[model samples]
Target: MTDTVADLIARSNRLGADPKNTNYAGGNTSAKGTATDPVTGQEVELLWVKGSGGDLGTLTGSGLAVLRLDRVRALTEVYPGLEQEDAMVAAFDYCLHGKGGAAPSIDTAMHGLVDAAHVDHLHPDAGIALATAADGEALTRDIFGDTVVWVPWRRPGFQLGLDIAAIKAAHPDAIGCILGGHGITAWGDTSAESEQRSLHIIDTAAAWIAEHSRPEPFGPPLPGYGALPPDERRARAAALAPTLRSLASHDRAVVGHFTDSDVVLDFLASSEHPRLAALGTSCPDHFLRTKVKPLVLDLPADAPLEEAAARLQELHAAYREDYQAYYDRHATPDSPAIRGADPLVVLVPGVGMFSYGKDKQTARVAGEFYVNAINVMRGAEGLSTYAPIDEAEKFRIEYWALEEAKLQRMPAPKPLATRIALVTGAASGIGKAIATRLAAEGACVVIADLDADKARAAAAELGSTDVAVGLAADVTDEAAVQAAVDACVLAFGGLDLVVNNAGLSLSKSLLDTTVADWDLQHAVMAKGSFLVSRAAAKVLIAQQLGGDVVYISSKNSVFAGPNNIAYSATKADQAHQVRLLAAELGEHGVKVNGINPDGVVRGSGIFAGGWGAKRAAVYGVPESELGAYYAQRTLLKREVLPEHVANAVFVLCSADLSHTTGLHVPVDAGVAAAFLR
Candidate 1:
């Protein structure tokens, strides 16, 4: 039930950590018991600090490493050499591991050297604004005076510890030390005191920078250079690199510089101050905090900065490409791959840095870091040179297997994933309507018809990119049906839905029906539907995306009409095929449905003439009477369009009717009901 020293240290670290703050790792802290054991009189155990990689936000009781103070002091004496320091650090870490503790941090030596019970370090951009300047030490003295001590940049281990010790010895009243090119280190009797001191130092430095630094002018330029070609722009960029590099080689300088002839020429050509060009950020670390860069556009030589910024979108595309390349190269293997590039920063000719991100949180962080870095470089009299990880290294991270796997595991888009559909007699009429509708709804539609030109035209009208294809074939031929469906899968990605809308109907009584008439009717309607559906189902079943076979049955399937023996019998056979398919494919996620439409008025030249004339003759009435006859039979009294049939097909193809398989949707105007009455 007793609280352990390890528990207290873990609690303190957790209370102080902030995961949202990227710069939190730059700070350090530690805690330990000060009293002796009541019964044994043994010194209470001490907890040494862990450094950077330790996220205090999630620190648990086991995270704290109990280090004997004597051992820590001995390790610090031998930590001057990098290799020796690493070895000693590893050895101490192993010792902690043996004691079931988290590995001790590399910065433990510095923490041990501090005299306070708790220590904290922070590398805030606001604080670094002063630390990165040429006369940063002098500036710190002027601002803080005797409140804090200042230390020059040194390798961060034993040397930093020794420097901190010397500074504290010289200024016994100092609350903390501002380590040059690094961050601030503060200490106190407790974690709160250390945290407050660190915050005070950052706030003080931020105030000083604000008071001393003048805001750089941004906005439109009068006018300057006009547009230039890519080659010339590249040459100009090369020409300016040396100057840019010279300006970048200062402390705390993360600079990005670019020269564009178009921007430069535009400003020069215009009446604006065309001589000024833009600058960008130089470091990736800056990108994590401030984004990439700013845009500096060239206005007329006499133009104001404000006007140039207003028209600054010209460079957006190029900046996005560069940002994408940087992200592609530098992203961690565990990070998501860039689908496309984004504009994180923009450079305007004659203007200062401008940072951007998709949201305010990212934008604010980027702006703070970028503006501070620009100030540090400008105050230092030049930009500091910093190298980012190379493209190859970045690519390795971007394409890491874990990230790829994570992305691949996401669910695919529905209604189109590997589903293929074929429309017969698609050159005109209900076939064309069905083909167009299927393609629009994401199914790959294959238009097969006797007219090659009409099939191709229908495919083009469907707006199917590559999913809708045209084939000139008589659907009745088994060989042609096989080839057509094969091509459908290849073109549309897969085969799943078959709208058996191709059919020919001839009116003939049993006495008048000849052998040729019977064969031809059966061939196109019964034979064609069977062949195409069979071929499609094979592929659909193989794909396992659930296959649908939709037979375009006529109202004749449910009614007996005069002089319609051959046509009526073929349609009945087609309807029966749907029932059989449903029974067979029910377990495979495939459904079979039929649309029994009374009359479809839309088709090619053939339907408007031959079929239309035949229907008129069969009804013993004018062709115009066809619509009224069908509408009068239905309950809704609505004239059925080809789209009505197409809509029914869509419902059958979807999962909404998954449980209602082997059914028929009467697209007719209640004609079956009229017949029953």
Candidate 2:
């Protein structure tokens, strides 16, 4: 029944990868095996544990930090009576079994002290729901018998490891131990055995909860708008999104996405939501993500969008004031003050719910965890009077230096981390450049194009991560355009930036321009831009977060060429579209701008679509020299690369342009003729 070292590693990855088990990398696992010391040529017992904040799902052997079992245990004894948490951490690090510098988990010592050969720790909801309740220990022993023991919450340190070891000595047959207000630690002789024991505990506890708990949820009134028609529902979302977004944001733009399904409504509609929600998170690790509590926003659905938005602005202000009050109540004179974040979750009765983050991924994760928190609280309350560790414990876990270590290793926030953007015609050329640039800056981007496969491929090319998603959307089709916006929200949580970059280019004299060419250009450029801008604006407004819509227009909007009537005329319409949007959306705090880039033939699909030869011929230059000719035409004599246009979009979306809107910024390398007058 014994599992190999590699088997333990694989098992840990599989368990950690599932957020249902642990939201993000919040748990650790370890295995004991015999290995010869490379230098000493002597066999020793080694313990390999999940490193700090490492993702278990994709984890490999190297992801684990190896420590000598004797050495790990020796630290507690040699450093007995240690009072500070930092000293234990240093001792654990000092006992690393190998040359690798990867930090051992704070729980590494906890794992080492266990008697079993394999230990798998997790933060599964069901188990945590049972472990963190007011009657947690009583219920655990009742449901699990003597296979596990209860270890009261202790700020993790060397003392914690010693305590767990003492409990294990008392219950030698115990397969797991519940860490109060934290999680479960299940151990066995084999990887499968350990996982099976953990899952059994989770399932049995879930069953107990299901049988005993049926607490109902009741949200504040939403008015008749909750039963509004489909169009009305969409409209409702559009108007409300921006107000919440604005209230959540500070100096920079912030976005939000809704969780409005029956499940969410059930949580919001809970008659006891105010009391149940204040019950705190079912798991301790969530303190870092969800905070101690969620901010609830209740707005009447029937209120005019503007009025509701205005009310939200007021409520959010009060929410911040209350948040500061909570912080001021809990802070100690000895510690540095912990800064508060915008509410991680919001509840709007009759409307729905939302989770906020710096960007789409973060928003989605927060939302997901909030829902899980609701479910756990419901289950716990339905069975027994539910209780979680108080505000004091939350502050301890959330501010614990060792616990925050994983987050400290995270890279600095990218400029657009909280923003979600969708770009039309993103499979190639300028659109592609913009999407890639946005992803690099930490925005979650969606690529929409007529070419479904190409769009997906382009998204894949950007990376395997969720930074970019692809959708096959014909911007000219109203339904397709709406679907694209929906897809962006589904993937990224909310939409903040909408780039109308999909357009058709044709080179023809006024007399030679075909009716078909003109219609096609208008459909994709003018009409497409209108469709996408309107759809995206709805989501942005619903988020209540000010946003940006950057149009990838052409220099022809200002300096029309003789033969390109189709492209020039439609581009002018696109340019005008920006002004119209800005005029309408400015009151909502959304900025609309245009980037007029010239000489974009290098990466533009226009060259591949036969425009290069035609435009070169029209300009009386060799086809190979067309790009050079455009560069020469620029006052700066610089090639107007797609990257230049992408940078212009960044600038337009940045806080630098927060005050400037409804204006065209030329990205054509200083073409004086195309300059905005």
Which candidate achieves the best TM-score against the true structure? 2
Q: Which stretches of candidate 2 lie over 4 Å from their true place?
A: 1-4, 17-20, 78-83, 211-235, 251-257, 299-311, 403-408, 472-496, 514-523, 526-547, 572-593, 619-641, 651-677
User: Which candidate should be chosen as best, given lDDT against the real structure?
Assistant: 2
Cα lDDT tens digits, model 1, 286-359, are 53344334434434323443344234434444555676766765676556646444433333333222333322
lDDT of 2 by residue, 395-483 (tens): 76676666556566778887787788899999999999999999888788899998999999999988854578788999989989987
Q: Assess every candidate by TM-score.
A: 0.42, 0.86
What is the alpha-carbon lDDT for the whole of candidate 1? Answer: 0.59
Cα lDDT for residue 165, model 2?
73
Off by over 4 Å in 1: 1-414, 604-609, 673-677
Shift in Å, residue 85, candidate 1: 31
Query: What lDDT score belongs to each candidate, Candidate 1 first?
Result: 0.59, 0.77
